[model samples]
Target: MFPIFNIHNVLLLVLFIISALIFDNFRHVNLEVIKSFLLENIQYIFIFVCQFILWYKTGKTEKAISALSDDIYKLHKTFQTETEKKEKAISALSDDIYRTLETEIKKIKTDILTLGETFKTDAKKAEKDISIFKDDVSKMCETSQNETKKIEKEIKNEIKQIRETFQIKIKTIEKYISILNVNINQIRETFQTGTKKFEKDISALKNDISKIRESGQKHSSQAGSNLSLTTNRISTIQNSGYSDTETLRSDFIALVDQRSKRETRGYFTPMLHALTEEISLSFS
Candidate 1:
């Protein structure tokens, strides 16, 4: 059998004995026994009371520490949540900034490309225009050179024709001078051979010849002046780079007509009359 007097049983028996003793004292009214029992267990009772007070104080302290730990944990969790929110806001703001910058950069690149294309087109157009201008200048210069050569050739031919005509007129004037000299020699011979009547006839013949010579000289002078004026007009026209043959012809014809009219009225008719009287006198 197991031992019946274990620690729990012994404690129970002690508690029962103490209870009976208190009961018996209370019933018999024994104050001294009661006082003696209390004195004997005083240390045990004081120790029990002190242990209970310590347990209560330890429980209260544990509760206060738990509540403080809960409050600290709550505060830490709130801080973490606020930190996460701030991080999200910063990330969102960074994304927005990056997107804005990227869009602006794309637009700038597109504009730069467009500007480059425009410059290239303008450069090509300018090159074409410059080429055309150079071609035009070359053509104009060639045309001017051709025209100048043609004008020079025409002027040379005109001068040659004028010179030929002038040479012919000079030859005709020399022939007339020879004829006048022959006539003057014939009059001198007649004057040396004749008497008073012959002297009168000779003087009249000399006067007639003098008049014819004066008229011939005047006609020659007028012809020379007209020739010089025509030459001057031709030179003026050539120097001015004009070529109007029709106008020159008209002017020449008018001058010739006027010269012919003057010669007929002033010299030719009088000369014919003088020649006829001289022939009649010579025959008589």
Candidate 2:
């Protein structure tokens, strides 16, 4: 068997022997004679048995004595000694464990304290950052509100001024309309008179031009005999520049006619609108 089984068997044998001895000693409860005889040697036998049993049980010291009193004293001494030794060893072990536990607890406490301090610092920084952010946001909101109010005030003022100016411009346009109505009446009368005069002048000029063209061409064709007329025609064209003067007059009249026609045909509306708009915008 293993050591554990061997040790258990030995313990069992010692217990059996103790049981047998106790039984033998207690048998015949009424025998006073046997009790006295065994009394003198009883301590010895019991000490021997106790020593043997104790040795088998736990390897304790033997309690050898001349008397029961001596045996008891020796057992007491052995018990005190063994108990003291165990107590000393246990005390040492407890002190070691206590010291180790104390060190670990202190280390843990220090680590916890460091973490607490770090957390505190970070919390303070977070609080400060939040406060700053709040302040910045508040300031931005205030500035935005102030700017909005300022812009609103400016816009209101601008709108009021625009309304006033628009009213003034309307009045000014009404005055110009009155003046334009008068001018339009005058222009209508002038157009009637100018139309007749322009038509008469154009008719006269056309007749003159036709006559000159006819005379000039006929002179060129009869170059052999009408040398004098040809000479006069060329001379008139060069000497005083009469042909150039006539062409200039004709071009002027043509320009006038084109202007009149352009106006009559509503081609001058764009110019009239631009002029009126320019006058109206002068207020702004």
Q: How many residue pairs clash (N, CA or C atoms closer than 3 angstroms) in each of the candidate models, in the order given?
A: 0, 0
TM-score (C-alpha) between model 1 and the true structure: 0.26
Task: Determine the C-alpha RMSD for candidate 1 after optimal superposition of all C-alphas.
Answer: 30.2
Q: How displaced is residue 191 in candidate 1, in Å? A: 6.5
Candidate No. with top lDDT: 1
Question: Tens digits of per-residue lDDT for model 2 on 124-236?
Answer: 99999999999999999999999999999999999999999999977865665565456556544654564465456546656655665678855655544455555564454
- lDDT per residue, candidate 1, 1-284, as tens digits? 22577544565577678768868767876788768867998998788668657756766686698888899999999999999999999999999999999999999999999999999999999999999999999999999999999999999999999999999987875665565456446544543443344446557656655655577756887656655665565455343322232333344344334444453335444543464355335423
The per-model lDDT (C-alpha) reads 0.66, 0.64
Instruction: Flag regions of model 2 displaced more than 4 Å.
Output: 1-120, 197-284
- TM-score, every prediction: 0.26, 0.29
